[model samples]
Target chain A: MSELAQALDTLARRRLGGDAATGLARMTAGATQEIWRFMLVKDGAETPLILRRAPGGDRVSESATGLEIEASLMEAAEAAGVPVPHVKWVLTPDDGIGHGFVMAFVEGETLGGRIARGEAFAEARKVLTRQCGEALAAIHRIDPAAFPTLKRVTPLEFVTQYRDGYLASNWPRPVFDLAFRWLLDRCPPPPENPRLVHGDFRNGNIMVGPDGLRAVLDWELAHVADPMEDMGWICANSWRFGVEDKPVGGFGLREELWAGYEAAGGEKVDPERALFWEVFGSLRWGVMCCGMANSFRTADPSVERAVIARRTSETEIDLLRLLAA
Target chain B: MQDQPTPSEILGAVARFLKEVVVAETKGATSFNVRVAANALEMMRRQLDTAPAAEAAELASLKALLGIENEDEGGDLATLNAELARRLGAGELDLKTPGVADHLWATTLAKLSVDQPTYWGYRAALAERAAPTET
Candidate 1:
């Protein structure tokens, strides 16, 4: 058995009280983390669970909220009526595995392309914009004061980090430089009422079923900032999956998203601020594309990241549309 | 002076093989990756065919905009771009500066031409170019 399987077996026997766990396979090809779905059998009953963990040891970066913290965040969100998979077990040292948590496997299509374009999701697409808004409202309603572990960042701080990241990549795309300077020059003042922002909230992070939005996933970049950040991120062109006309995850209009957010009692939907962040979001994705390519040369050498590097130009054009004529 | 097939032709041949032969043999995620790999080869082919002229134009624009002659003489595109980035980051040049916006627009358009000609934003820009000029 693989080390992961053995550890999972141990974890299952101890925590889940399962007789066996079979069909351990990777859920997706992730650049930063490993996700595995398996069936735990106890008394001839089967339970589906997902294991999420960093591939290496716990060298948590400043931006990451850490797996343990993420597990706790999921619990908090679940309790607060946000749709998240129920976390069952958080790894301990005795589990003899790297940092990770296990949760009840939520069944849905998480692929952005399918969620945006597939015919099967026609109904889901109809409800996604409003559901996305409602979910964000629930997420933002989670009081940051309750969870001190969640990083609190101001707009300036995040912009500086992005600028530093671009510099670190050393790719020297001047268009990114222009966008970065533009963001710095126009950085919005700190929101009067800061709330929990799903820092990476967008198409792929959302899981959808034929019914509607099933679960909001991937809290790795969750932080406390302007709640509008979440709204702007969803409207970013990168998440549209080529359905450029539909701003809300390529499934619905911005007005529909705004209406949904307003209906959910989210802070009055700020169109101007959202537009600003939309521009910032495009530049951010451009920087991230370069970062992925840099990772291809640096720590993680994956063809996926290498291909994504070429996508920086897509963002460049996105920036032009947002910033210039 | 390599032989007759040329770099872009070689890239086109490999892309065709990946799309036609390898893609047919593969299934599931590998199939998706084969298509992505083929697309990357197409991008490379475009880059190889277009980069020299684009780089030369970008270099000339950078020299004029930054008011520096021979600043990039001993340097490559990456180095010259890094210098420009440093200046832009330091606020020495901005949209208000002469030629800055035009240079960025032209350079980014050049990049889209090579990396993603069919991207919606690029297509929109092309449409705008084709539109009749207002009085």
Candidate 2:
């Protein structure tokens, strides 16, 4: 058995008292996490489960809530009536699988392209923007008082982090330079009552069924900030998957999303601030793309990372488009 | 002068083969990586065609905007861009500065014409630029 397979077997036996872990296979590798799917056989019953862990036993995160917090946030999200896969177990050192949690595998199409354009989801598309808005409102409404570890990131701090990373790259991106200054010039004052922002709320991070909005995934990026950040992020051009006309994840209008957010009692949706964050979102993704390429050169050498360098130009154009309008 | 199958054509062929053959042969992570690999080749192929002209135009525009003549030795694209970025960061140049926004837009659009021509933002920008402007 492979080392990970053995670990899974041992973990299943120790944690769930399963007889064995069968059909173990790795899922599509997320940038930071190793996802392994297996069926835990216990008392002749097979339970499909997923192990989401930091790569190489190193706690992999950048401005991320730790795995333990991620699990807790999911539980809190479920309590707030957001769709989520039930977390089955949180890994302990005794389990020997490093830092991560086991959760029930969510069954749905997570592909942004498919959900945006697939005929199967045509009906779901009609209401998905509103659904996403509602989901974001739920996430924002989750009181930060519950989690003491969570950091409250101001809009300026968030932009500065990306700016620092970009400047460190030592690559002179004129468009990026302009975009950063523009964002800073118009940075909105921090919200009177900051709320939890689903930091990576966008198309690829969400899962959808034909019925719609099955699970809101990848909560590690969650932090306390202006809730409008979530609103702007979903409307960012990168996540639209080519359907840019529909500002809400390529399937719904901005007004629809705002309406849904208001219907769910979210803080009043501000169009100007939302636009500010949308521009910020493009710069953020551009910085991240450049960072990936930097990682390929300086640390991790992967084909995926190297090619991503070209995508920085994509964001450059996106920033120009956003700013031009 | 070299061969009938030019370097650009060669890259395109290889990318197509990977997308058609390797993707069919592999599943999951390997398949995804192969697709990205194919995309990289296709993008490079496109860059080969578009970069020379676009970069020349960009360099000319950068020199004009920065008032840089070929007196000193530091005129490479990267070095010039770095200077421009530094000036922008130091508040020397901004969008309101004459030709700054236009230069940035043209150069960025030139890059997108190679990297992601089909990207909606790129297309939208083209459409906007082509549209009749207010007097």
Q: Which predicted model would earn the best lDDT?
A: 2
For residue B119, give model 1's deviation from the true position in Å. 3.1
Q: Per-residue alpha-carbon lDDT of model 2 for A113-201, expressed as tens digits?
A: 99888999999998788899899888888989998889888889989988999998888898888888888888988778899877999
After superposing candidate 2 on the true structure, give the runs of residues whose Cα lies further than 4 Å from its correct spot: A1-14, A17-20, A57-59, B1-35, B69-74, B132-135
DockQ per candidate = 0.64, 0.67
lDDT of 2 by residue, B1-135 (tens): 687789999999999999999999999889999999898898899899888999888888888889977745457899989999888866789878999988988888878877777777788788888994787
Worst 10 residues of 1 chain A by lDDT: A55-64
- Which tens-of-lDDT digit does each residue in A214-244 have in candidate 1? 8999999988899988898898988888887
Q: Please give the distance, in angstroms, between residue B80's alpha carbon in candidate 1 and its true position after superposition.
A: 5.0
Q: Estimate each model's TM-score.
A: 0.90, 0.91
Error of 2 at B36 (Å): 3.5
User: Candidate 1 has which clashing residue pairs, if any?
Assistant: none
